[model samples]
Target: MGLLNSLINSFSKTPTSLSERVTTLEIKTVCLGKELPDLEHLILIKDRFPRREKIKISIENETLEEIIQIADIPNFQQYQNFKNKFFDDELEVMITIDKKVEDNKFSIYCFDNFMSDFLKKETSDIMKAFNQLLKLNNYLIFEIFDSSLVPSLLLSTETMVFKKADEENTILESDRLKKIETCKQNSNFYSNSNLELIPEDFHIKTDSNSNLRNVFEKIETLLSIAYLSNSAFLEKSSFKIQISGHRMSNYECDINVQKLKNKEFYEIYKWTYTDGNPADKLIIARNAISLHCKNLDLINIDETVFASIKSNFALYQKENVMQYIDLKNKLAEYIVKLTTTSNDMIYGLFDKFKNNLIAFLTFLLSVYLIKIMSNQSVGSVFTKDVTYLSFLILVASFLFMIIGIAEVYFQKNKIVNGYNELKKNYEDILDKKDIENTFKSDDLLKKSI
Candidate 1:
């Protein structure tokens, strides 16, 4: 009676509340001719019956059902759509085996979505979480949506993407040939013999003039200019389109296939605005370039693609600014060290002037002393005119030395203070000993001095 009541309630779509419990329940879309292991309950819906137990199932419709047994139903292969559900102590799950379409894919909602308690669980990485969910020509997508019913992510496996592309096939033969012709015509490097070219394999020739990191940057700039030759930057911001599968044709070079396979993907399949089977070979090859909007559990998902590009630019700007500042500070500190001595003496034009002034004063004093001792005319040697001029010269030299000293100290303090402030603000990026060594190092850093 208890089991029968559970089944009756399941048919009504009422889920039992399981609080503070999270367990993984994985189920394939189709399981037939046998039962799953270690399940408390199961249901094998043979087909969408026109009338099953007084319930109208006239038209085939997608459904969510609950099962109370684990054993596989007998002769489950011929069923148009079969659903199996079971509850272990931790999770309640169901498997839908729909043979209606050859491309039988499933969607697993990772969030609770106020729908059921089962999908409320969380994981760091969705790709790793459902790696094995797709098996035996079967594939599943992990989707996350918010309260507003907007998808945060629509992720799937590589196999799922390739198969979808295969189903949809390729673009029109004329379209492929036209794109190839455009590529060949635009690039001067492509000769008559090397006529075949496609957007995926086409690249701007690299120049020797490009600086360290500027080569890639220049390529990006040129590509953008060519693509946006007639259109404004954000002119079609609101336009949206998704290309579907098509008849087969080789629109791109064979090299494009290898390039796609060799790509290092930092993130999973991402799509926004437009999705489904790609119509272009390049689009089909590099899957993640399809811009995404909003955080969808995948890595680096942003609300706007523009926002993502802006963020990357900002990071690069910050890094370059720091490098320039670091180099400038080192030069300032070097000047301070080179100009000053161990005894706090600065070796410059001012020092030379001070030494020469002292020597003249000493010579004049010696002459005056000798003339007085020999009973000579001391008044002539130490005349009023000479005395006044010597006094003025002494005062001027003293003032100049004071001003020079002040200027040197001001610049030295400025350099030291700047380094200290930068180190304090970026403490996490520096080591404990970096404060003392920043200005002292003369060794070059990665093409920088």
Candidate 2:
């Protein structure tokens, strides 16, 4: 009787608490033909539904449910249309597969809004977590699918950024040609050629400058950028769009189909954005430029380029300012170190300047004394003017000694205080890993609340 009641509840159209629980319960056997060993470690449940061979999973939220239903289409065209109506709410995809031997059953997920934004900010973090999972699982595959929701603005025919941030030496026509050449070469040689150039391979020249074209070349070579169809740095407009995918293994490059054969683990794919709808090639070039800016020495920043970066990208501003502060603080410490000496060395050098000053004074005094004695012996050989000059010299020497003493004292005291302050601050700053761990723990707590 209990079994019959449970079966009835599972199939019910009307929502009951038990029915809701059943919806959330992962039907593992349907997805992973064999029950995954050590199920506790699984990030997503592998569920089996013998009756419903056509797989379905539901979330507690209705808005999300609608988004999933919209995205559930199997073809790229349908998914592209669904992407056009993107809203602010988060979207997650749940996959189901039919029973098959080996690993035939799998599902893929894409973020809606909130998660997309979160993962965008924490791209490196997402990669780290996914790689960890890949190491743990022994038999899964992961890949990032490259699908263009919209064309990029920077790479688009309507848009052109002509001015270099530094100065006005025009991006010459020849330079533009060279960039195109590089792109053509990249298409022929590399597997992940920038998507913009993918059309070029078919003899469709979406014409642009060489620098912009070269950006496409680099994007073609880089795994992450090639898949996104736009640069990660989207300035000039705030319109938000992103790309994402999941991996079945660590070795699998998300955008490349050729690398999937050897992968044997699962990886949650990343969400990336290129705002302003810049051309995919332009986005790639911008990223390379941004990376170059980061490696610049702290003491020398190109003011014009920096101004442009500050005006355009918020992330660049935060990162550069933090780096600048660290650089300034380190220089301040070096200045303090150069002025101070070890305690043992200090004892040997202490009063050394004063002693030198004293010796010079003694030698002058002796010369004056000799002149005075000679004048007494010879009567008019030394006059009153000579005596006055001797007195002036003595006074000047005393002043010199006083100034030297004050300089040494001030420098020594200043260095000692600076060192002590730095020591205290150094003690307060915990290990980098510990600091990051604390931040993660705090975030988890806040999310729970």
For this target, which candidate reaches the highest lDDT against the unseen true structure? 1
- At residue 276, candidate 1 shows an lDDT of 25
Which digits, one per residue and each the tens of the lDDT, describe model 2 over residues 249-272? Answer: 111133222221100000000111
Q: Candidate 2's C-alpha lDDT?
A: 0.32
Worst 10-residue lDDT window, candidate 2: 262-271
**TM-score for every candidate vs. truth?**
0.23, 0.19
Clashes of 1: 12
TM-score of structure candidate 2: 0.19
